[model samples]
Target: MPARPPARPVPPAPPPSPRDRLLAEAMRLFGERGVDAVTTREICAAAGVNPGAIHYHFGDKDGLYREVLRLPVAELDRQLAGFDDPGLSLHESIRRFIQPFLFDDGSCNAQLFFREMQAPSPVFMETVAREVGPLFDRFARLLARHAGMEQPNAAIHQLAMGLQAMAHDYSMTRPMLDAFHPELLADDPLLEQTCHRLADWGCALVEFERQRHASR
Candidate 1:
């Protein structure tokens, strides 16, 4: 038999760009500690980049923060890409809408979001309302369809927000889960089960609303 040739060495991966590094570190810092507590210099130091890199890439710390905040919203938007389709079944629509929040990526995005919700800065509130409002409105519209309403009312919006919060708790309350019931986040199967349960609950809520609306 012919001798086997030696395997070639694999090339090393390239280093992250300054911009990428800044965004990553800023996300971590801002997520763990509120945006007000995190400093640009600290982020630059953690990212191993010069402070000016933030200025060069994002114009300023506020710009960098805005970009970082958008990352998770972008992921949710991608997950929700056909969420508003009238053809989708109610169960499937609820599943798709809440699935993104079922798993934690171990990033600070969820933390940051919840933190902003608790005691939001003016800038954070403005950015989040502008970016996230349309997504919430879409979900409310889907809920309205399930409830047989022509359009979403304030009650429908409240229900939509509550359902979303239920999903958000799975990811955002990791520490509490770890301390209380670690099994909930122990595996993919469990997460999927939770997602399905939440979807069922959402359907039930919609049905209740539909019956109530019909009675009027």
Candidate 2:
């Protein structure tokens, strides 16, 4: 073989700009502690940016908080919308709805939403209405159809909330669940089993409610 010349070195990647850094750190801190509890200084420090970076990039702390709140919901909405196919069965719909939050490990949106639920800010309800409410309504409609209900009644709302809680509780309680029962965290199989149980319970509960309402 002929001798080859040495290759040139590749340049290093550029650091994240202050705006992007600020947004990322703000989202993380706000997820860990509510916006009311986290300060601009802390976010700036975490991002390795100056204190003025928040004002420069986001206008103010509240502005950043609002962005942080909206970012996760927007992503989750995007993910759930992919499952809106009319042909999806009830169980499949439920799986797609919960899969992103429970199984997809790349995004911190689920943790952020859990934190928002724990200590909501002033814009919580508004954010939910704009970004998350439609998804919940879609799930409710699916549940109602699967359970053989025609109208939007109290039972539908309750079943929707039940399913939502079942899906959300896994993310919120995962740390505790892991600590107490590490076996559950051994691998993906356990998590899949847990999701199946949640789906089963949610489906059964909806049917039970349907029966109860029918007898009344």
Candidate 3:
């Protein structure tokens, strides 16, 4: 047999760009410590870049924090795309809207969101209004359509908020669930079952509101 040729060594992977590093480190630090507690210097040190990198990449720490905040919102928007489709059944709409929360990836973005909920930065409300508010409004409008309202009212908005709170609870209370009921987290089918049950309840609630509105 002919001698085998020597294998060529693989080239080293390229290092993360300074911008990517800054974003990643900022996400970690902001998620763990909240934006107020974290500083530009700490983020730069963790990213292994100079403090100037933040300004170059994101203008400043506030700019970086805003970008970090948007990461999860972008993911949410992707997941929630088409949730308000007119062709979807009300149950499916509810399911689609809430499913992301149940099967949350538990990424750093989620932690950052939780941190923001607990202690929002100056940018948080503005960001939510600009990005997340439209999503919520769309869901509310869907609910109104099912409930026979010309538009979403205060009651419809309240209902939308309540459903969101329920979905968030399943994700946000995961740590407690893990400590007390580990099997719940481990069971995907069980989570799906719970999601379906919630969807059914949501449908019933909408029907009830529809009847109530009709009677008024």
10 residues in a row with least lDDT, candidate 3: 182-191
lDDT of 3 by residue, 120-198 (tens): 7779998999999999999999999999999998988999988888878887787787899878758664478778878
Please, what is the whole-model Cα lDDT of each candidate in the order they appear?
0.86, 0.75, 0.87
Query: Evaluated with lDDT, which candidate comes out highest?
Result: 3
lDDT of 1 by residue, 1-216 (tens): 999999999999999988888988888899899998988889999999887988999998889988988888788788889977889899999998988877767767877877888998877877778888899999999999889999998889999999988998887676787789767657754478889899999999999999999999
- Winner on lDDT (1 vs 3): 3
For each candidate, give its TM-score against the true structure. 0.85, 0.77, 0.88
Error of 1 at 204 (Å): 1.4
Which residue ranges in model 2 land beyond 4 Å of their true spot?
1-14, 48-50, 103-112, 178-190, 213-216
State in Å the error of residue 182, model 2: 5.2
List of clashing residue pairs for candidate 2: none
* Candidate 2: C-alpha lDDT: 0.75
Best by TM-score: 3
Question: Per-residue lDDT tens digits of candidate 2, residues 157-178?
Answer: 8778777776666766777887
Count: clashes, candidate 2: 0
